[model samples]
Target: MKICVIGLGLLGGSFALGVRNTLDDVEIIGVDKNPEHSQKALELGIIDKIMTMEDAVPQATIAVIATPVNIIEYQLPFVLDLISPMGVVIDLGSTKGNICKAAEDHPKRARYVATHPIAGTENSGPESAFKGLFRNKTMIICDREKSDPIAYQFIKSIFKDLDMQVSYMDSVEHDKHIAYVSHLSHISSFALGATVLDMEKSEKSIFAMAGSGFSSTVRLAKSSPAMWAPIFEQNAENISEALGSYIEHLKSFKEIIDNKDMEKSTQVMNRVNDIRRVLKGIDIKS
Candidate 1:
């Protein structure tokens, strides 16, 4: 089987590594806009051969779009157009609604599957990829009925090989839920990182007193803006709602602490502690 992976960053390169490690007969072809990234992926053995988008799409039995959400929107229709009748085109865009809608009216829409694998690190690029990155992670397939039955089954089998647990959701619900869980968390991390850095520049020795707690909380801030900026734009409505709730909670907490009402603060924390139970069953990632 020939697989073409576009956008040779952490997600794309990691996917190539994961699938290659799992399947013996698979030939991996990489397509990237950056020559430097292609070279790096080659050095890391993430892809077997580097090819351009035009040269690779038709040759591929499967084409995986691992680009940023914005790129995926404009790129999906083109990929569907290039794929053979039996070929499957799967996307790994974080947001779902816009990407699914982008290819909704395409003649070859059935050739595409809109998917979001709920796994990633704050790192990116070919050098950052590793095998098993998606292992045991949740792979959400949106608008399942729109994809051809044979193509849908083919996608499920691939994710199963990678040890991903498959789940189905409507594209609209996927976007709304991810805003609170994934998007909001990233925004918080970025905001916190900026707050501390800005404070440090004003003469407070912040980093000197920082510890693992701070490190863990702010880790998502290191994620590439090239990738995240598009996600923020694409899912602004949902993300904005999530942010409003997060901000209201912050204000409530601040008011409690400012008034030195330790009893109410303790109650709030005790209630939030239930999240430990919710997260315990899963392999948690940022």
Candidate 2:
């Protein structure tokens, strides 16, 4: 089968690599707005060839939209218009509500599947791509009932080949859940990184004493702003709610510390440690 992958950045390049590694008889055609990214994907052997979106969609059995959420919202309908009736289009974007809603009323909506692979590092670009990036990760399919059964099954099989555990949810619910679980984490990391950097200007040798815990806490701050800024905008309501709740919790903890209520603070820590039980069910590495 021939697959056309749009936006040959980290997610797209890694997806191309994962598919190529798992499927022997597949041809991967890459499309990127950035010519440099397309050329780099070709040089890295992530795609069999680079083609314009206009040229690639017609030849592809499946077209994967791995672009930023905003671009996915803009380009998906155009892609659906170009692909054959039998062709399937899948989007691997982070935010789902806007992208899904964009194509909701299209006549060829049944040919499209909205998916979010719940995985990635705080990295971007084709050079960061690698095989098995989605292995053991959660792949969420939104509004699966709206997609044609055959198309849904085909894309599910492809994610299965990449070793992903697939799940289903409504598009709106998916966006709301991810705002807390995924988006809020990035915001926290970014805020923490910024706070530390501001402190470092006044306390010049601060980073020299930084340890692994600090590095881990701020890791997601390294994620691409070009990608994340759109996501934050698209899922603004839910993310804002999540941030408010997080801030309230932080204030509560601060209250406990300010009051010197060591026992209450310890109780709060012990209560949150219950998350370890939840994490044990997932394949989180130490």
Candidate 3:
């Protein structure tokens, strides 16, 4: 099988590595707008070769769009146009509703599968790629009924080879749920990081006092804006709703503390502590 992976950044490069490690007799072709990333992917042996979209799309058995959300919207239709009849196209974008809607009426709509693999690190670039990044991670396939059975099965096989757990949902529901579970968390992390940086101006020794908790909480803030900006825009409505709820809870907690209501503050902490039980069943390792 020959797979063409667009945008040889962290996700694409890591996908190439996973395929090479798990699949037999497979050729991985890489396409990236950045020459440095292409060269780095080659040097790191993440891809077998590099090719232009025009050349790679026609020959690939499967084409995976691992670009940012905006680029995925722009390229998906063009990719669907170029792929052979039997070829399958899949996307790894964080936001799915807009992307799936873009290709909804395309002539070859059945050839494309909308997927979001719920896994990643706060790192970017080809050098950040690694094997086993998708292992045990949940892969959400949006609007599955819109894709051809053959195309969907082929993608399922690929994710299974990478040891990922697969689930299906409508595109709208995927975006709504992810807004709370994924997008909101990133926003919180970014906000926390910004607050700390602003405080640093008044306290030079603030970072020196930071420990593992602060580092872990602010980790998502290191993610690339180039990638996340489009995602935030695409899911703005749902994310805003999630953020409003979060802010309300924050205000309630603050009020309790301000009133010196120790019992109420303890109840709030205990109630939120249930998340530990929920998280015990989630595999977030990358």
Candidate 4:
């Protein structure tokens, strides 16, 4: 099988590697807007070769769009136009509602599979793509019923080979849930980083006190702004709702501590401890 992965950033680069590793017979080609990323992908053995969409789309058995969310909106339609009847086009955009809506009524609407693999690191570029990034991770496929059976099966096969567990949801549902679990987390991390750096400006000695907890929380703040900014804009309404709720929660906790409401503060702490139970089921290493 011939697979062409566009956008050789962390997601695309990691995908190319995962596909190639799982399906040895599969030939992987990478297409990147950045020439350097293409070169790095090849040198790192993430793909068999580098090819353009014009040269690869029609011939490829599958085309995966791993670009940023905004670009995916415009790119997916063109990809659907290029592929044959049996060719499948799957996208790994973070936000799905807008992109899915864009391709809903196309003549080749069935050829597209809208997916968001719920896994990543704070790193990017072909150089940062790593093997096993998708392993055991949950991949959300939105509006599966709207996709062609063959296209959907083909996509399912790819993720299965990568050891990703699949879950189905409507696009709107996916967006709403992810706004709280994923998008808001990134925003919080970024805000936290900004806050700490601001404090450092007044007290340079604060850096010496930084520990693993601070590092872990702020790590996502180093993620690519180019990739995240569009996601924030695309999911603005849901993200704002999530942020408002989070701020309100934080304010309540602050009031409890400020007024020395020991009973209320203890109640809040115990409730928040449920997060430890939730994290226990996941394989994240602290």
**Cα lDDT of model 2 by residue, 28-109, tens digit:** 9999989999999999999999898999998899999999999999999999998998999999999999999999999999
lDDT score at residue 215, model 4, on the 0-100 scale: 96
- TM values, all candidates: 0.98, 0.98, 0.98, 0.97
Candidate 4 backbone collisions, by pair? none
For model 2, give the 10-residue run with minimal summed lDDT.
277-286
Q: After superposition, how far is residue 247 of candidate 4 from its true place, in Å?
A: 0.8
Tens-place lDDT digits, model 4, residues 50-133: 888899889898999999999999999999999988999999999999999989889999999999999899998888898889
Task: List residue ranges in candidate 2 displaced over 4 A.
Answer: 284-286
Q: Which ten residues in a row have the lowest lDDT in candidate 4?
A: 277-286
> How well is each residue in 5-102 modelled by candidate 3, as lDDT tens digits?
99998898888899888889999999999999998999999988989999999999999999999999999999999999999999999999999999
Per-residue lDDT of model 1, residues 1-286, tens digit only = 9999999999998899999988879999999999999998988888889998989999999999999999999999899989988999999999999999999999998988889999899999999999879998999999999999999998999899999989999999999999999999999999999898888888677698889999999999999999999999999999999999999999999999999999999999999999888788663532
CA lDDT of 28 in candidate 1? 90
Clashes of 4: 0
Off by more than 4 A, model 3: 284-286
